[model samples]
Target: MRTLETIIIGAGPCGIRTAIILKEAGVDVVVIEGAAPGGKINIAPRVDNYPGYKMISGPDLAAEFFSWLNDAGVEMIGDLVTSLTKEDDLFIVQCEHNTYKAKSVLIASGTKEKKLALPKEDKFFTRGISYCALCDGHFHKGQDVLVIGGGNTALKEAIFMADIAAHIYLIHRRNEFRGSNKYVKELNDLPNTTILTPYIPVELIGGDRLTGVKIQNVETKEERVLDVQGVFPLVGQIPNSTYVKIPGVLDQWGTIPVENKTKKTQVPGLFAGGDILPRDIRQIYLAEVDGKMAAKAILAYLEK
Candidate 1:
């Protein structure tokens, strides 16, 4: 029943940054992470938007962040958090193997990729369908693949697979893309890329493994199937805030609504930031800023 000043529930950009700041301030704080330290950034193939480096890989950036945590003497606990509850102004964090009590808590768990929810999607999980192009693109060399979504992730993955896969079929529910114009232009110029707009995936067609995807045009209600060996669905992200047991703190999407200035949630001593907060843009720097702000806010709250 050891209680600390603060506990962060993630090790991503936001969590890492928040932990560093709190540690430097001499606050008793610990970060809990279930997966790798870098979080979703580890899955990214390339990151060209971060402030410091003009171009760098996601893993590289994450490694640098880990180094900072080490140098700052921030303690990180590796465990999967199951739930969060508050009792008598103290927060209780429940994990599979252990439990922790903290005076304050920060939820920076980030987001997970949204699934198409079509039947057979689970059956072909690793057989052919994948969410990470950098991890599975090599397996589809000289083969055809389907990329579903209309965001930057979909565009980037499509471009990355173009070199390995013989052909890339990118399908989106809308005719217009939600990604940057630069990515759209680059993806269009690729000789092996074909853009299918206004199409929604209706079913995943395969036997033992995925072989193709059945899509329908949103406008015409016409249906067609694309023959491919891989399916990358980068449709969107869903907040990883199920551990938050507090009612009225979560929105319809499960994302926590926080005060823009301080990242404070509806409950006192409970803060949220980074990808868990509803925002149009999701980036490492923005998440870092959220962490810094939340840490500072926590410090101020602790002072009182």
Candidate 2:
């Protein structure tokens, strides 16, 4: 049972950035990650927004981030944090493998993809229905696939699958997409992509594996079935803050409410950053900023 100065959950961009800043300031900090170091950024195909690089793939950016972390001598542990409990002045973080005690904690677990609550969705999670097009798009190469949603993620997934899948059926509940104009234009330019607007998914038609989907037109209430081997639903995401249950801290959306400047939550020693915070815009740059602010606040608290 090694007691640490601070424990940051999730080694995504937010956690990684926090670790670098704290380590540079001579703070004892450790980052706990469940999966890979990149988090959700790995699922993205292209990222043109982050400063410095005009256009770079998500994996490449993630690699650079990891390289910086290594050079900074930041410690990262690969483990899934199950829960966080406060015992007197110290916070206890319980993971599947071990438990850790820390004076302060930063929650940067990010968000998980939201799923379509259609029938049999759980039965075919890995069988044919998927959320990440980059991860499962190769499996549906040269075959018809369906992409649901109208956000940036959905459009990106459709565009990435366009090259792999023989035909891409993009279904959206609204006629207009919420993604950027560039992505919408790019998706429209692809001859292999078919845009279906004002349509909602009714049911998932398959047994063990997904074979097709049943959708209905929102206007005329017309129902139709699209034959596809794979389905990628990129609707939205839910914050990963259920593990840290603090009364009166979480809002209605389950996001931790934090002061924008300091990233401090209602609880004194607890802070939050990244997608887990109740920020309108969730981006890599903003998450990095939040991490830096959290690290500064923690360092000040430790000094006091």
Give the residue spans of candidate 1 off by over 4 A: none
Output candidate 2 Cα RMSD.
1.1
lDDT tens digits by residue: candidate 1, 118-145: 8999899889999899888899999999
Listed in order, each prediction's TM-score against the native is 0.98, 0.97
- For each candidate in turn, give its C-alpha RMSD to the true structure in angstroms: 1.0, 1.1
Which 10-residue window in model 1 sums to the lowest lDDT?
43-52
Which clashing pairs does model 2 show?
Answer: none
Index of the highest-TM-score prediction? 1
